[model samples]
Target: MTDDRRRRGLEMMRQVYGWEVGDAPGDFFGITVDHLFADIWSRPGLSMRDRRLLLLGVLAARGLNDVLDIQIPAALANSELTAAELREIAIFLTHYVGWPLGARLSVQIDTLIAEHERKRH
Candidate 1:
């Protein structure tokens, strides 16, 4: 069951992030595969799109900047989110997550959007 779940998670992750589970080194990467991807991500209640949005919001609020580097572009490339929606989310999160963090997120997302577009051509 664990293997199946991991495989499914990897597929989903690749579909969204274009990243492989083993692409990076660390126990945390393993946990991301086993727990985040295999466990939470495999749950059926939320659509993948909804989950992506929640992940983005939570990571932004927590100021998980590096993780956002990975997720922001993936969400845009996969069409899980739009540039406008991301901008809106940044504004929405500002009141709750703080202006500095939310503004940082908005800028990063804008940069990633440009990168995503460049890659498509």
Candidate 2:
């Protein structure tokens, strides 16, 4: 994680997710998106959006559906993946990951959108 991207991720965690940590505890090595974004996403070989799609694939393939539900949209929002792009990605996943998983993701995204809307309301 470059200092700049690390700083940005931490700031976003605090501001967006209300995460709290001083010097982040050791338990947080790569438990969530921070490490991936700063370390893997910043790699010269991959674009941020491509990295996000990769992560999304990993999360889905590993049956990390709960985490994917949150990370997918967060990745979209943070990594410049447009909603249409995300929808297309999700569609592509159904063929590999099955309709059930894709449907669950679609529902989860809807839930995230509704929750955000409720907060705004």
For residues 1-121, write the lDDT of model 1, one tens digit per residue.
Answer: 3667667767766776766644455677767876777777778899878988888889999999999998888788778888899888888998899989988988988888888889889
Model 2, clash count?
A: 0
Cα shift from native, residue 55, model 1 (Å)? 1.0
Per-residue lDDT tens digits for candidate 2, residues 3-79, read 67666556545433334433354546533436644444445886655656787887766668777766765654464
- Which ranges in model 1 have alpha carbons more than 4 Å from their true place? 20-31
Worst 10 residues of 1 by lDDT: 16-25
Best by lDDT: 1
Scored against the true structure, residue 81 in model 1 reaches a CA lDDT of 86
lDDT of each: 0.82, 0.61
Query: Which candidate should be chosen as best, given TM-score against the real structure?
Result: 1
